[model samples]
Target: MQRMLDGLIKFRQEDFEEHKALFSKLKRRQEPHTLFIACSDSRVMPEMITKSLPGELFVVRNIANIVPPYKEVHQDYVATTSAIEYAVKSLKVENIVVCGHSNCGGCASIYLPDEVLNNLPDTKKWLELAQNVKKRVMVHLEDETDEYQREWLTEQINILEQIKHLLTYPYIKEKYLNKELNIYGFYYMIETGEVFIFNYDTGVFELSN
Candidate 1:
């Protein structure tokens, strides 16, 4: 806690002071260009990775970066869904990136038994959003036995699934069809600091040049 406080003080004294004009303008309003959905993992810093400024990306960090399918019936996902709606409809963000990372606990949790997540009811329920990814892996990658390989595949699949889920929103779909919105699936490899982008034309995640 002291470390964070000290950093805050340093930021106020140094970085904030240096960028006072930018911060001052941002104080009144913000117009971010992209909606970045990424994992809540401390290891994955979307801004740091992308070298994005504060007002450049509107970020939404959650467990596994999951984006549930759009539904007419509202449930407990108001926070996530509302952020997406506001980012798209209000902020007019042109790009939406669903970024999933390697070594994601949320993705790994899908392979664990129900008992393991029994005490974490909310987490268990929230992770149900990634069930389709797990099922896809099971049916497609059934012959693969390596644990790390499986997890990596799950993470990539989850990103694609979340992108699909994002399109379920009417406004997003309309904007996307009209070429007003671009959706992207990203996978970050923690060990190597490499980012891969899902290429729609090739149907593969290729390393970003």
Candidate 2:
């Protein structure tokens, strides 16, 4: 806590002061260009990675960067959907990027035994959103014995799955079909610091130049 407080003090004295004009303008209103959906991992810093300013990107982070499918009657409160609705309908963001990272605990938890997730009932239920990821991976990549390869593939597949779910929203679909909004899937390699972007034409994720 002290470390965070000290960082806050430094931010106020140095970072904030240096970007005072930008922050001042942002203080009144924000018009971010992109909606960045990323993982709740502390190591994944969306702003730092994209070098975006305070008001440039509206972000929503959740476990495994999952985006649940659009449904008229949601059984429970969903912060992700609310943020997506606001970003697309109200904010009118031009782009949406669903980013999944390497070595995601949420992705790994999908393969764990029911007993393992028994204590974390909510998390278990939440991760059910990515169950399709597991099903596809098991059927397609059954020969992949390498732990790292399996996890990496699952992370990338999860991003694609989330993107599909994102399109389930009518507003997003309308904008997307009209070519007014762009949707992208990103996979970040934490160890290598490389980003792979999904290519619709090739149906594969290639290294971002």
Per-model TM-score, in order, reads: 0.97, 0.97
For model 2, name the residue pairs that clash.
none
Q: What TM-score number comes out for model 1?
A: 0.97
Each prediction's Cα lDDT score?
0.92, 0.93
What pairs collide in candidate 1? Answer: none
Tens digit of per-residue lDDT, candidate 2, span 1-209 = 99999999999999999999999998879999999999999989999888898999999999999999999878789799999999998998999999999889999999989999998999999999989999988877867677777887899899999999988998899999999999999898888999999999999999999
Q: In model 1, state the lDDT of residue 55.
A: 97
Q: Model 2 segments beyond 4 Å from truth?
A: none
Give the per-residue lDDT of model 1 (tens digit) for 1-209.
99999999999999899989999899979999999999999999999999987799999999999998998889564889999989999999999999999999989998889889998899999998988999998876856788877988899999989999998999999999999999999999999999999999999999999
lDDT at residue 177 of model 1 (Cα atoms): 99
- Candidate 1: what lDDT? 0.92
